[model samples]
Target: MARLQLRNLEKDYGGFKAVHGINLDVADGEFMVLVGPSGCAKSTTLRMIAGLERVTGGEIRIGDSLVNDKAPGERGIAMVFQNYALYPHMKVRKNLSFGLRLKRRPAEEIEQATRDVSNILEIGDYLERLPKQLSGGQAQRVAVGRALIKKPQVFLFDEPLSNLDAKLRASMRVRITDLHKQLKADGLQSTVVYVTHDQTEAMTMGDRICVMKEGRIMQVADPVTLYNRPANAFVAGFIGSPEMNLIDADLSGSTLSIGSQSLALGPAMLERLNPKAASALTFGVRPQHFSLVGAGEDNALEGRVSHVEFMGHEVYLYVNVEGQQMIVVVSATAYDRSKIQGDIVRLQPSQETAHLFDRKTGENVSLADLH
Candidate 1:
C-alpha cells in the first residue's frame, strides 16, 4: 500500500482554474473520499492523483516517490471510472487480464490472477460473457477486478457506483468496502481514493472525508466529526440528510433576532461563540436538533406550521418563523396529529448543537470550543 500526498495541487483550464492549491494526505491502506457538489473539482483532484490529468503546479507523491511527471501507467495507481470503461467486445476473463497481458506476464500467472479476482468478486460464472451480457453491478465488479489484478500501490474510484440503481449502489458500496478489508487482510495494497458528489456514499465509505467547494478543500474529518462538529457553515449545511437549517440572523449579546422574532442563545452556547463574531451571523441548527415545545416556551422560536410530511416513524415539520423557513423532525408518535398547516408551533433549538457562523466568511464562530 502507498501513502498518497497532494501538496498545493492545482489544475487550470486555460483561463479558468478548476482546482485551487489544495493539499491532502491519504495514509497507506486508508480509504479517503473526496466529496462535494457538482463543479467542485473533486473529480479533477482524483484525476490528478491518478495522473490522468496534468497538474499545473505542486507535487503528487505516491509512497516516498514524487510522481508529478509520471505517466498514468507508471504512477502505481489503478483507476475505476464512472462508466465501467470495459472493452465491450472483450469477455470478462480477458478484461480482467488485460492489464497483466499488456505487461506480458506469464500465461499461468494471468490465469491464476483471473480466477482469484473472479472468486473474490463472485463474477466467476460470467468470466466468459461479454461486457454487454453482465448487469450494471456485475460489470462494475469486473471493472474493479481489472484494477485489483494490477496490484497497484493505490486504487482510485471516480463515482464507480453512479451508473447503478439505488439498491445496486447500496450493495456495491458494502461489497467494495468489504473487498478492501479482505485485500488488506491478505497483505495486499488496499489504499483507496474515492471521488463522489453523494454525501451518503462519502459518509459511509470513507475513513476520513474531504469536503470541497469552488476548487478548495473545506474540511477533512471522520464521519462523526463532519456531522457533529462541522468546521464551517458550508459543511454544517451540506453533510446532513435534510441538510442543516441556516437562517440569517442578527446577534445581540446572547440573543439572535430572525426577522421579527428572536430566540435566546443559552449560556452553554454563548460561552462557545468566538468573541470576535460579527453581529450579523447565521443561526445554524439541524432538523433533528429542534424540538417541539409548548407555545409559551421561553427560548423557543414561534412559527406557523407551513407543511407536514409523515415519513414512517418520523415526521418532518416545516415551519415559517417570522418569514424564515425551518424544519423540525419529531417522532411520529409524539407529533400532534391535530396540528396541521397554519397552526402555530414553537421550535426550540438545542443549546449544545446549535451553531453560529460569520455571515460574510461562513466561518462557524461557535466552533471555537469544538476544536
Candidate 2:
C-alpha cells in the first residue's frame, strides 16, 4: 500500500504536449479513476506513474520515496491492461508465478504466492488450464492474479474490462470492487489508479475522478459532486447519461428563457444563480429534470414529437422545441406514448435542478457564486 502523488505532471512527445502540468494526491488505500475521451492522455499519465512512460517534467512519489527515474520493475507498481497480455501456452498457475521465478524467489515461496492469489481470485480449479482454454472473464482474472502475485504497492488498471463482452464486463466491475474491499480488509494499504473511457466505470469505482480534456484536467471530484455540481460545460456534458440539454438562453429580469419557453427560476433558482446574471446565459437541464407543468403561464413547452424509443425501464421521447432537439425520460409503466403525443407539452426543471453557464467562458457561474 502506498500514497501516490503526481506533482506538476506533464507528458510531451517531441514538442507536442500530451498532458499539461497537473497535480493530484491519491491517498493510501484509495481508488482514483482517470476518465476522458480519447487523446486526453489518461494512458500516458498511467504509464508515467508506472515508469513505463517517462515524465516530460515532474515528480512521481510512491509513499515516501521519489521514483521519477526508476525503471519499470523498480517502481513497485502492477499494471493490468486491456489485452490481458497472458501467455497463451502457459498454465494459469505458471503465468501467475512467472515474475517471481524471474526474480529468483525460493520455489516454496513462489508456490505459496501462486496458490494464495489463485484462491483469492477463485481460479484454483483452472490453475492447470492455459489461457487458450479459459473464458474471457477467466483470462482477465488470471491477469489480475499475475499482478497480485507481485503484491505491488499500487494497482494500475487501464480499461481492463474493455475486451470482454458487455455482461462479463458488468460482472467484472462488481468483482473488482469486491476484490478491492477484501484486499483492504486484509490490511493491504494499496492505492489503485484506474483509467477508463466509460462514464459508468468512472462514477462507480472511484473515490475521486479526474476528468480530462485536450491534455488538461478539467475537474477532480467525487461522483455526485461531479454530476450534480459540474464546474464547466465540458464536464457537465461529459459525465451524465443522455447528457444535459443545453440551449441558447437569456435571462431577462426575473425570468430565464430557453427558446420560446420562459422558466420561472423563482426566488430559489434566482438565489442559486449569479446575482448579476440577468441576461445572456446558457440554460442547462438534464433529461430527467423536465416535468409536465400545468396549463397557462406555468411550466409549458410547445413541441413536435420527432421520435420515441421504448427502453423497457423507461421511454425516451425526442421533441423539437425552439429548433433544438430535447430528450425526455419517463417511466414506461406510469405513462404511455398516448399521454405525450402532439398536444402542447409542458416541461419544467423540477426542484430547481437546472444548471446555468456563461455564454462565453462556459464557467459555471451559477454554482461558483453559491459557494
Index of the highest-lDDT prediction = 1
How many residue pairs of model 1 clash at the backbone? 0
Give each model a TM-score: 0.97, 0.95
Clashing pairs counted in every model: 0, 2
C-alpha positional error of residue 215 in candidate 1 after TM-score superposition, expressed in Å: 0.4
Cand. 2 Cα-lDDT: 0.85
* lDDT of candidate 1 over 80-166, digit per residue (tens): 999999999999999999999999999999999999999999999999999999999999999999999999999999999998999
lDDT of each: 0.92, 0.85
lDDT of 1 at 206: 94
Candidate 2 lDDT over residue span 1-371, tens digit each: 49999999999899999989989999998889999999899999999998988888989999889999999899889989999999888998899999999999999999999989988989999999999999999999999999888989999999999898889989999988888888899997557999999999999888899999887888999999999988988898898898888777888877777776776677666677777653777778888777654445365566776887889988787877899888887777755444454555666566367788888877786774545
Residue 302 CA displacement from its true place in model 2, Å: 2.6
Worst 10 residues of 1 by lDDT: 336-345
